[model samples]
Target: MSLKITDECINCDVCEPECPNGAISQGPDIYVIDPNMCTECVGHYDTPQCMEVCPVDCIITGVEESREVLEERYRIISGQKVA
Candidate 1:
């Protein structure tokens, strides 16, 4: 699942930089995660870096996606697609 920053977020500005895929961004309010670019850090790290560094634990999983889906996103983002 792609991690999302909830309304509970304190806007601490830590999670944005921690996302390896650059999926997290500062929204009009709190941070937002782009599911299209999110791989849950499956290919880049053992766990989502945003979730790791969030000070308030406001990051939560959303729209549960299988590992296959996450890995496919990683492959495409990394330019590893067979084409």
Candidate 2:
């Protein structure tokens, strides 16, 4: 599954650059994760890099997607899939 930044986020501006999928962005109040583009670093790393670097631990997994689905999502986002 992808990750979401909670209200606990300190807005430290660290998670954005750590996301390999470019899913994290500055929201109105805190950093937010884009579910459509997030792959939990499936194609880039073994674990979620955003969560790794978040100081407040506000980044948490969301929308329980299977590994196969996450992998497919990454492929689609990375333009690895053919029509």
Candidate 3:
């Protein structure tokens, strides 16, 4: 599933660079993940990179998406259509 940054995010900017898909971006206060670009790192890594580098462990799964959905998202981001 797609990950979401929680309120625990300190706006540390650590997670931003970790996202390979460039899904993570600076929000009004915390980091936000663009669902359209979020693939849970399926195409690039074994695990989510943002969650890996988040100091506060604020990143969590199950944010309005499922694994199948995320996989489709990855395909879309990689210029492939979900079949």
Candidate 4:
């Protein structure tokens, strides 16, 4: 599942750089994660980088999407399907 930044986000811009997929971006009030681009660090890190760096614990995993769903989502975002 993709992670999301809650209202608790302090707009400190800390989490933006932690995302490996470049899914995190500065939003109107807080950081935003593009679910399409987010693999929850599945192929990059041991865990969600944004959640690890968030100072206020504002980042949380969204509804748990299955690995199949996640892989498909990643494929769509990356424009390549896995074999």
User: Alpha carbon lDDT of residue 22, candidate 3?
Assistant: 92
Clash count of each predicted structure: 0, 0, 0, 0
Scored by CA lDDT, what does every candidate get? 0.88, 0.86, 0.84, 0.80
TM-score of 1: 0.93
* Worst ten in a row by lDDT for model 3: 62-71
Candidate 1 residues 1-83, lDDT tens each?
Answer: 47778899988989888888899888998889998999999899999898888878998889888988899899999889633
* Alpha-carbon lDDT of model 3: 0.84
lDDT of 4 by residue, 1-83 (tens): 46788998899988888877789999887888888788887766778878887889988888777777766766766778666
Candidate 4, overall lDDT?
0.80
Model 1 residue-pair collision total: 0
Candidate with top lDDT is 1
The order of the candidates by lDDT, greatest first, is 1, 2, 3, 4
Cα deviation in Å at residue 47, candidate 2? Answer: 0.6
Model 4 lDDT-worst window of ten:
70-79
Per-prediction CA RMSD (Å):
1.4, 1.5, 1.8, 1.9
Clashes of 4: 0
- Whole-model lDDT for model 2 versus the true structure? 0.86
